[model samples]
Target: MAEISAVSEGPRTEGDDYRGIMRFAHLVRADLPEPALAVLDGSQAILVSTLYPDAPATLQELIAGGSAALDAVRAAIADGAAVVHELTDFTFASAVLAPPAVLAVGLNYAAHSSELGLKTDAAPTVFTLWPNSLTGHGQTTSWPRSLSESVDYEAELGVLIGTAAKDVSEEDALDHVWGYTVVNDITARDIQFAEAQWSRCKSFDGFTPTGPVVVTADEIADPQDLHIWTNVDGHMVQDASTNQMVRSVRTLIAHLSQSLTLLPGTLISTGSPGGAGYSRDPQIFLRDRSTVTVGIDGIGELTTHCRILG
Candidate 1:
């Protein structure tokens, strides 16, 4: 276990008025096939790689580098020494590219549990998500109709752990949070019910679309008080608040930490609200060419285009 608190001793932020919390994300340029870490600056993106010679290349690196690396990047941004590019010139990537693990909660919302015909356990229902399922905002997610035609959408809040935490108390759980982002826990509904486990049903390639940006933990006042919702094609499908969650972010972290150390850069998707397409009067599914957007107020919106293959 390393020290959780680290004070930055590198180049200091030149101005106290730099403005805005550092919104971090991976940005992809046509020339650069791989995504690069960047800070979203209004209409521009400050490449973290160009910020300083030793800047972290990804969110996981930044988290591993701790406050020192973050402060250095902040200082470089405020010092105005790095080159920046138009925000529109580059496409977005998952705020979290790779993590130690991708944990998710299920039936955490009463409405979602009731509608899906599942029971919300006295303790949280947690599961693991595969890395292959992770994709960025504005990307296309396709599936073979032959595999499963009943794909569904779930709007969820994603939490990123900044430090290794074990057996943490509920009161201190939030201290380990690095940032927050949006996650659409897309599921194959028929498979979800047919299978004894939830991971496989939801872990298809590109099934978990996240990001656009990861707002630092400090930017979010209360994770349990934000607005979380979803839209399919053009209509609003799921609309609810994080307040509706059966277990708060802190509670989930505390409980999970009791079992093992949540390593740095681990992501915990806090589960979805009600209004799953499967539970509607006339059920809906992500059809070919359909689009879905799941968003969290004060954070960012994540969109995924759907394509169904024969």
Candidate 2:
């Protein structure tokens, strides 16, 4: 794994003094065709490419460049390279616009498993989410009513791997993590229950929404301690801590690495906690025009608007 430099410890301020150590991605305009990597300093965003013309254009590129590339970005920030924009000036793209794969873990949270009448498996229930499903914060996600009306919301913590790993130990698994983000693992409950497989039901276009921003792993002291929650149509639907995972992030990474080489920029959506809409007493499914927001305490919140088309 690339060595992450120590970020200055202090309260983040506005203007130039802003901390540039934490990297995020956003589209400067809604019309912009691609996401640009930026250094988030307070309410401002400094475009990495703009600060240094030779800098990487996307997060994937930056990660591919390793620690030295990141160090260059930090150095540019510290030197006060003046081109900065207010965060409000741009809209967000998925924090992870592109990745090697989007791997989701299921039955990794006992509460979620028990509530859904499913048993915790001896091995992690893993599934792939198609790339077409990926969307950004504040974007509207729609599905046809004919697809089945039982669409549900799941608030999960997303983990991004910075380095490839093969047969890594749980004790050293976290070293490969690049950062963390929030994920709204939207699901078509009816399809999910009906099918023997999970990917298609959950991989519908726009079903997996991620990020307002991705915070580097160095910023997070303990992934297990973060508070994760979800709100749908203004009501708190799912609230839990990362501590509830049946398999810790470290355990999941290590376990996964045992089977295959986990590539850099791979996104792992750790299982959601209990309180999924599918398991609610009255059953709270996402309805037409509904809005949902999933958030983690330190990481930014991700919101998605829903449109149920006939």
Which residue runs does candidate 1 get wrong by more than 4 Å? Answer: 1-17
The most accurate candidate by lDDT is 1
Could you tell me which 10 consecutive residues in candidate 2 have the lowest summed lDDT?
1-10
Evaluate residue 139 in candidate 2 and report its C-alpha lDDT on the 0 to 100 scale. Answer: 86
Clashing pairs in 2: none
> How many angstroms is residue 103 displaced in model 2 relative to the true structure, after the best TM-score fit?
0.6
Colliding pairs, model 1: none
Lowest summed lDDT across 10 adjacent residues in model 1 is found at 1-10
lDDT of each: 0.88, 0.84
What is candidate 2's lDDT per residue for 3-76, written digit by digit as tens? 11233334223344545248586554655566777777555666777767788898888887878887777777
RMSD of 2: 5.5
